[model samples]
Target: MTFANVGTLGTKPGKRDEVVAILTRRNPQLESAGCLLYEVGTNDDEPDTVFVAELWTSAEAHQASLSLDTVREAIAEAMPLLSGQMGGDRFTVAGSPLRG
Candidate 1:
């Protein structure tokens, strides 16, 4: 089943942009690493937050992505910018932009 993992990152007062930059650069690599869809977004109402949306071919593929060198590096770089606990919701794909 397709795995949809959506998450939000709350960064330190001035660190949101940097966190987003790192994630933005890494997103394309995720697609190369078996992610069916990958996106990084921000919320205007929440300036310190970065939103992540990902679609993987399977749960294993999502797990494998965490082990990828580039992904590991990105995580390390983004970790310090995190100011609060990461929050997320997982879903099974019943409908999506990719379904067509």
Candidate 2:
């Protein structure tokens, strides 16, 4: 089943851009690992928040991605810029009009 992860990360004040950059950086490894889509967004009304939407081939693929060295490094780099607050949702996709 297609796996989806949609979440928000609370960054330190004035650090949302930095966190977004980290999340959006090019990483071909993600595609190789079964990532279908990975997007990062931000809300002007919530300057400290960074939003992420990810689609993966399977839940296991997403979980395995966490152990990737590049992913781990990016997380480490972004950690200091975060406020330690985070929220999000994960689920198996039921259906999507955009999919065939």
Candidate 3:
């Protein structure tokens, strides 16, 4: 089953852009780690928040990706820029027309 994760990260007042930058940086390891889709976005009305959507081969793959050195480093870099506020949804995708 495809594991999907969609979330929002609230950044310190004006740090949304920085967080987005960190999240969007190219990480080929993600593909090797089983990431199928990874997107970072923002809402104009939410100036301090960054949104992310990700699809992985499985829930375990998603969790394991966090242990990648580059991923860990990115998290370390973005942590201080965040406000510690986060929200998200995770689910096992039943099917997708795009996949077929």
List clashing residue pairs in candidate 1. Answer: none
Q: Relative to the true structure, how large is the alpha-carbon lDDT of every model?
A: 0.87, 0.95, 0.96
lDDT of 2 at 20: 88
Higher-ranked by lDDT: 1 or 2: 2
Error of 3 at 68 (Å): 0.4
* Residue-by-residue lDDT tens digits, candidate 1, 51-100: 99988988788999999888899999999999976899998888758457
For every candidate in turn, the CA RMSD to the true structure comes to 1.8, 0.6, 0.6
Best by the lDDT measure:
3
Off by over 4 Å in 2: none
lDDT of 3 by residue, 11-75 (tens): 99989999999999999999999999999999999999999999999999999999999999999
Better of 1 and 2 by TM-score: 2
What is the Cα root-mean-square deviation between model 1 and the actual structure?
A: 1.8
Worst 10 residues of 2 by lDDT: 91-100
- Quote model 3's TM-score: 0.97
The TM-scores, one per candidate, come to 0.88, 0.97, 0.97
